[model samples]
Target chain A: MNDSAIDQKPQTNSIISGAQLLIHLLEEQGVTHVAGIPGGANLPMYDALTSSSIKHVLARHEQGAGFIAQGMARVSGEAHVCFASSGPGATNLVTAVADAKMDSIPLIAITGQVSQTMIGTDAFQEIDTFGLMLPITKHNWLVRSAEELLEVIPHAFEVALSGRPGPVSIDIPKDVQNELINFRPKSIDSTDVKAPCSALDENDIREMLAIIKNAHKPILMIGGGIIYSDACDDLKVFAETLDIPAVQTFMGLGVLSNEHPLSLGMLGMHGAPFTNLVLEECDLVVGLGVRFDDRATGKVSDFCPRAKFVHVDIDRSEIDKVISSMYSIHADVGDVLRAANNSLQHVTRPLWRQRIEKLKESHPLRLDGDDDLFRPYGAIKTIASMVDDSANITTDVGQHQMWVAQAYPFTRPRQWISSGGLGTMGFGLPTAIGMALAQPDITTLCFSGDGSFMMNIQELATLAEENLNVKVIILNNNHLGLVRQQQTLFYKKNLSAVKFQQGVDFAMAAKSMGVNGMNLGQVDNPHKQLTKALREPGPWVIDIPISETEMVFPMVAPGGSNRDMIHGEEQ
Target chain B: MSNENQSLLKLIVNNHPGVLSHICGLFARRSYNLEGVMIRPIAGSSSHKSCVWLLVNEVEKLPQLIRQTEKLIDVITVEQHDMKESIFEKTEQFFI
Candidate 1:
């Protein structure tokens, strides 16, 4: 289509309501959909959505709405919107909002505040939403006037997406949402958001380069910050040029194409066996955008005991917050990559490359090289192949999260989103809800461990109500797989709180929520069931009943090197 | 370990409201735990930013803790200067 074919200019000079202005601003920012539940306090806003072009999904609950927005934001790399009424509705959205804030997903939560007259009077369904959401949000505002709603609505989106990216909120009084005010939409500038100072210190950069050049074994640990900064290409190039072994955190998945030789899968508690081993043995660790979370480096004192760190991050506070640094570069990963590309000479290290190859062979993630019945690897491979390169995938924390990280072949950045630092359970369902809301056109897959899936199982009702086409894969081992594996290794098979006498009937649960569900993993013809689920129109769940005895291998024991892996039960 | 003049302190205080604000404010605002402070919520806590344990040495800097604790409305109590006890009962793991 030609530029002239579309309406390029702002249409009218007519007076409009504040609700309409809010809608117009949201449309101007290319936002077409919202995940929310309407109530008396903001009935006018819902009524306005009917007149405006934006589509709104009525969530079963406010928490579900917030999480759906989170999924949307993570997938689209843009801010997502969610709304709730006063009191209980607003309070219910807290956990989801806090999830977005913790994982640094860009989300906008607009709550309908009580009437301005009800302020401090403690009327029915009245709560100070702005005050309640303070700790969980990056920036929050109380729109006192209808005129302020126009400015604040768009501004909230800007703050939520800019810089580090987090959830922001705006509380609109019920009266303001209903009032007809002369709407004037003006673009706001937020360029002054405190960003990491540009350009790494010259000495620091040079020192880091020298260390990389000198080290016999060097590994690059990438984190969520890298994806947030959109510096995947630079990270990939740096790793390739130096032939460094690279291990990513859970958030750092998809930073490098899974096919890349330098990509050594994930590291930490549930990380690949070789990844942890290499990290331990490496003489130098070039930290890029990763916040050395405790999960990745168990006992910090003994973590990478031999490695000297060249910690590079945009946040100055994170530099020495965890591991002490041999050289610290506080700048955007993109800037550092450009600087490194210009300064460094290509030097091949055959020995270093060989070591990486050995590590891969030693602790390869093989679900079943021959045991076709246990199809963890095959299932992951199939899922990875089936989804679009750009499709977004969120995972619940557990064995499934780790398996996906190790086996799923991601070819682009930001395709995989998870609760990395927090290892939060119940993250998958909400994030998937958000993804489907954000990218309604693209298919989203949320892989959840049976235990983790149960934590936020209630969100299924929200998905059904909203009619979101989100596909969920429940890896049902009927046990806390990771914990079970840990106990088997360390506690001499004393499995406690690991087994469930009767597995949850997810199919029935989905039906209760008015959604489609099936147990596909145990079916002789699972392909047909899985294909049907993928093609279904609304939110769907496929419970894959995997073997409970199955253990995700290449495990690194506490207080041991990654090389010292307890591979299988017999081993 | 005593030769290093470093003590790894673990204090389980009340998961009171504004407890984090006070503890962090005391450390960050007053530059008390400036060397480094890693505070994460202990697994089972209903309160917000509650049940946070701090890993710091210089437990002898007690008077500072008491004064800061008094200023914070959320802090239920202050338990500092427990060196030998922490070594015996290592409830938490310290990572860098």
Candidate 2:
């Protein structure tokens, strides 16, 4: 089968058993690898995989399998596959499915089920996998027969990778997998699908470009969608050509290089103080492939109160779902931005640059220079300076996540991976493993906090087994710092359920899991030790003691607008 | 969602098996309850499609839901009807 003629009607049944057909389809899709675990229910597919050319990675846990597939998808922009069995295997996949939905990553999750006869009889390992996945998945199907596999499997891929990309699940009963079916490849067109970059109305684009051209202070806000559409380079060119300073959401970190003169790093609650202030002063914001998430926009109404929004998103729903876009374009962001750069005339905004320069000088990411304790900012800065700009960073959710976004200078798309929207804790280690497996040539770093690191600490064994080059950097504050900070600030210093009463030695914990650990807690110079961890190869956990008192600053208090940031004077 | 705020939402979608699940699941995830649902397959269409009517609360999040619902792969078009224009109201009259 030539790659160019995938749509051609197959002359004959190029498949045998249902499981074999599934493998054939995967091969046809050019799937290099699949990450999953084998169980009693899905043994048929696993058996087929054994005889097939497709490489199967046996993950320690179903959740880990999901994230590994996520790593592959996030990096390559390809719809990757993961497998799980019924009951527990299916249940464990929920978190990752939700995470994919929140981040809009393209993933196809195939789970096994009880035999068709015992589907509702409460048989062994039987669970409503389809029902459980419905909410988290973009779409799902329970294949009743082997004959349906031919249609459902290909349709799943189309749904997962199309429009605003997300996860799609297909639950196949055990008997269905084993059932032999004779079928010819019917040229069923890939679901009434819309093209990726749809044509935009010329008048709409003209109106948007006019607003952008007239604005004195125009800012470009980029998001994960830009990366999904492979528009980072185009976005950078448009920003540079028009002299528009660009700010990004955490997911949008690498859309423009951090060193780019116009790049203002991240914006929102945990965003840079200077960037937030710049947004406040700007007259217009050109949002490309970005949703105005509350985390990025502070209080929805008060966020950039003076600026008129010109939003460009592939999904029509995101256009005015949050902030009302005075001017909006419905098309792929890369296409729109490329056209905008070509069609619109360039204008210099010298006054806007001066204001931004002053803002950056006055309110840089704050760190007390004299404090010698292992603050997150200092440690992150040291790692950033030590590692090459090409290194990929994954993180778990907490204060550490915010600090990583604030401190690390990421310069490429898909280089920054974290559980952004879902904010799933314990995402760092396993996700890092998946990322390393996807691209072994580049060093992958996992930035985690003590609290978040403990969520999926079981994956340390998996890391050791694979011996992948993933450096686990943990900020051991001996407390849930983010929760404690909120308690102290908003709850009148009433801290509860935030302390790690019996301190678990992370180094010893990692060693017990058969992985080497290095403690930078008591060290005078941590950067040199970290340098060794980066180059030492394989998985090494570097645990550094940080202060629970050091809160991630420039925080917009809960229910507060971005403008109402709890900053220097208030602190 | 408020008790007095009933919104009659209508959508035209391809008659795909999982399309209903996608729309309903979206609302379920947001914890928004649907008051009622009615779907009727369009007859004699070149591409088999259906018209669906959902009764929900007209809240601030309704617009977002509408947008999301309209974005589903199977959905062709979506329209909103106030109390007077509601098909649910007409159906209620039919039952009465």
lDDT of each: 0.73, 0.83
What lDDT does candidate 2 reach at residue A463?
81
For each candidate in turn, the TM-score is: 0.78, 0.92
**Residue B38 of model 1, lDDT score:** 44
Superposition error at A402 for model 1 (Å): 2.1
Which runs of model 1 end up more than 4 angstroms from their true locations? A1-17, A187-192, A199-204, A366-375, A382-391, A458-469, A480-503, A511-514, A521-524, A531-540, A554-566, B1-96
Q: What lDDT score goes with residue A82 in model 1?
A: 90
Model 1, span B1-96: residue lDDT tens: 232344443444544333455456556544555333445565766644344445554455534444444323234434554445544235334432
Residue pairs in collision within model 2: none
Residue A146 CA displacement from its true place in model 2, Å: 1.7
DockQ of 1: 0.04
Model 2, residue B39: distance off in Å is 2.6
Highest-DockQ candidate: 2
Residue A64, model 2, lDDT: 84
Off by over 4 Å in 2: A1-15, A195-198, A369-373, A522-527, A568-571, B1-10, B14-19, B30-35, B44-48, B55-63, B79-96
Give every candidate's TM-score on chain A. Answer: 0.87, 0.94
* Residue range A1-571, candidate 2, lDDT tens digits: 2112122223375546677777777777788889898898988888778766676777778998888888878877889999999999999988988999999988899999989999889999888898898888877888988888877887888889887899999999888888777757656586456564457677876888788888888999989889988888888778877899999998899888888899998999988889999999999999988888889987788888889999999888888988898888888887787776677556677889999999999988676422342777778887777788878999999998988888788878889998999999878887887788789888898999999998888888878887888888998888988999999889999999999898878889999998889789665666677788788778889998877888888898876888777864432
